[model samples]
Target: MTKNNLVFETLPLYNKQSLEELLKNRINQLGDFSFEDDKWYYSKKNDNPLRKEDFIVNFYQVPIQYKNELKYYALLSTGLPRVIRTKCNKISQFLKFIDKTYLELTIAEITRSHVNAYEYQLRLKNSATYVKQGYYAAIQDFFMKLTDFDDTPNTVPTKNINPFRYIKEKSKRKPIPKKVIRSWDRVMKDQDIPIPLEFRTFYWLIRSFPNRISELLSMRRDCLKSFYSEYLIQIPTTKQSGGFIQEEIKTIPVAYSGHGKYVINLIQQLQEQTEELLLKNNIEEDIRTDFLFIVQQWGFKNNGDKPSVRYYDQIFHLKKHKINALFKQLAEILDFRDDLNQLIIPTSHQFRHNAVTDRAYAVGYTMEQIRRLTGHKNEVMPKHYTHQLIEKHKEIHLGIENLRSSNVSPVEFRGKIMNLDERTTKQLSRDPRRYLTWEANGKKGVGICSDITGCNPKGTSVHFECYACDWFVPKLEYLKDYKAEYEYWMDVVDRTSGDTKRAAHFENAIRNVSYLERILKICKNGIEHFKEEKLQEQLDKFNTPPVWE
Candidate 1:
């Protein structure tokens, strides 16, 4: 993969602007600040509403040769307040590294050798590839993006190749385990859990919508809408094209039930609280200040740990670190542990991975269709995650206690055979929505109903009869249920005797037993055919363990 090839982390937008034009623009204006000065105290930007530190860049902190180049990229790359601060901070580290390497060096004097040495030092100090790559990113952007202007030397040798690709390492980020998420969901919705609405609602949004924390954190107060019968959220495409090239709005339709519905009510409550606090403080909520996360603080201030004083307790911008702190508190309460039996620290992005992977499971979705759910710039990740999910099945902790259909995936089991793969299932089914939760057979999730309408006929023996239906998908976890039902049909067949009516009823019972046996065989075939470790682990997750164990 090329540098910034992941496309999720950063967008290279300054390719259209040469180094010369940006330098001129930097001296003219960046929002309200003219960056020609030595130091800047910038607190607000037009685009992003999230709370962040001042984007103060003291050019004198870096040697003169690199100062203007840093200024050019920072100004042109972003207007988002937090990102502007991040660019300044990450690029500053690179400049500091250069200062120690050579007593004095001009920007033009810097070559690939200097960059290679810097990268070597980063690798030596940090084992994580993404962490090291992050430090080099701004510098890479500086060299790769700058164009020569007379009186300005922009001839860094590292400019030729993509900085992101140069790192040549994959991101270690993977989906958080589904079991942990289910636990988190249970805790998040509890009324007595004492999780502040700000953190709970914030996390709920991440769980419901697959997006980066940055995008959700900057969510506007007016983000929600009632589109006819459905409710949609106007998520700011904050990370689109690296948060600068073009600003777009993505509409995510929220479910009418579950946490989806709860979040809408929560947002409304937060908005009202924000309005009340603003009125009490004699402040007006404007576009810049109207945000969902920023609300009246009750328990220690939302941004920090300090208790809120009566007059001072007003809506505050919930910082990114504050959310991190909140999750740690929740994790501690839940006593969430990994396979190693170690305490697991949860993160905001963990929810996004699970959300994306779950959406990708809909076999009817194309790579392009999945991108809409992922908010990804390219279709690459939608395809990448399918294989990644199968590879990382072990790292994912699924429940062995419950035989819920959520743990069973017939689509995956079918995909093992060439003729009955996910692609083939899509071709065979007329409906775009092929999978629906089946809650019959005296259980919440016994199996999957491919066509719920066709299978459930009035007054018919639809319970065990589903085994014979073309649309019904038998879950491996429900193997015990199948056996029990088969016994019931067999008992009925043996008991019945006498005339033609009784014989016909006995024949139907025998037919039911045959269907159940066929389903049992299909489940057995799946176990034998998919002996692969990944598929086995998934099958083992929900199967009822032996009674002795």
Candidate 2:
């Protein structure tokens, strides 16, 4: 994949006439802002100067030849700060590659061979399929649009691959542990605890609902509204709301009891607190309009100044880092750690994962219902966890049915830590094998223990066993969780290697991987998805060393 070796003769000869037209359009396109400036900013109105920050991109690093053309591609494309910044940066990498390889070559000179070379470099530097796509697609997008007015619709020889969130990081997401949640629950209510009042409110609010920190940050002062017997909170979402729809409202229902009641109370308290701050006059100009959060600000110049604050800055607290930092501060205070004695730094996203898995484990929820809250436009969900409760409530109201999501009937075991319906109670008199899924009604239960007595009696390893066990009944509805688990364990299999005492770990990995594959088959296709009869026989196929090979 070199420039002179020219592997692709498919691209039509360089059309100078087309280049002139494209450059003309770009020149007119950039009239909203001066090209002389080294930095570009994003604003609701392009006329307004974007506040100087890394929220957008800095064009100062991009080379002179490709800067305007790259800007044309991005400015007309996605306007998201995080997205545009990354796209611009990746395109800059392409231009830099061109600078190194060819003499004063512009973006137009870069062809299939150059792109393949750059994509090869991406493969060397990155491992995640989606991460490579995230970088490669940017340059592809640039060329795709740059030649839009050319003779053909096809720009680069490369084709676009849709990056999948489920294939990437979502599968690895696990709910925050019950021990940690219980500890935090106790600590949050203690008046004497060192946690900030606002942070405590943030924790409770986020914990109560499956929501992102961004959605919470942009919540209106008048978000909570009572409808009939229940309450709904209006959440402004822009994560993937395309076109002229800058935002859309995603409402989550909250009944007036249990955590829902607590959540409702805490939100009112926060509103009252921030309302007092609304008296201040120095609000930041570009703060999200009528949002819930408003914090007093101090710049680098105020390092040694007194803690007294006269006004609130109305600054946007949409970024996750600040909330994550607060969580870290709390984690350190709680001295939180796992069985491995590893310290845990809980973030806002884990709560969302918990909410998703909780709903997914039960058959009452549908994929469409769950997708509403996750704030994604096309992905399977962040929505499911978001809307799981609404659908769960309907199931509880109708009473449990003999439900099935596949050929193998799923006994919807009320997950421990389950919090959807406050009305569901444990059936103490029922036999373990006879149980159908019941509502949690707010009572916590982990996924059903098939042992009828206790866990770990079979001597099975502690990781992902339920996913592989014959008693582990899976179905179509729980496919998202399975996919995530499958992707996660695959990564674990890739990382597994051992010799002496560590041989136990290898054996366990093989067992878990084989079973997960079987379970996934049962989940997707039906109960009749196997040929091998025994666990030992299934385990035989994984006996090869260099597991990745």
Q: What are the lDDT scores of the predictions, listed in order?
A: 0.54, 0.51
lDDT of 1 by residue, 1-549 (tens): 122221112212452244345355544444455656666545434333343244455666766767776776665554554565676777777778888888678665676778788877877784566666677776665654443223223344443343434445677885666666677778777776556667768877776556778778887889887744346677665443233333345455544444445777887777776667656764435434776676554433332432222234455677667677767755665577766777777778777766555432221223444465468877444446534422322121111111123224242243232224464354224222223334434565565555421222111133443454444566666677778877877776555422222433443454455556656766776666566656778888869687899
Off by over 4 Å in 2: 1-38, 43-51, 58-68, 93-135, 151-155, 159-175, 190-197, 240-245, 280-289, 295-320, 331-345, 357-549
lDDT of 2 by residue, 244-352 (tens): 1145465555565545566678788878867776665555565654767655432211223211113334444434566786666557656767767777778888865
Candidate 1 lDDT? 0.54
Error of 2 at 263 (Å): 1.3
RMSD for all candidates, in order, please. 22.3, 19.6
Residue 382 C-alpha lDDT in model 2: 41
Q: What C-alpha lDDT, on a 0 to 100 scale, does residue 512 get in candidate 1?
A: 59
Name the weakest run of 10 consecutive residues (lDDT summed) in model 2. Answer: 300-309
- In Å, residue 400's CA in model 1 sits off its true spot by 43
Instruction: Count backbone overlaps in model 2.
Output: 18
C-alpha lDDT of residue 405 in model 1: 34
Could you tell me which 10 consecutive residues in candidate 1 have the lowest summed lDDT?
394-403
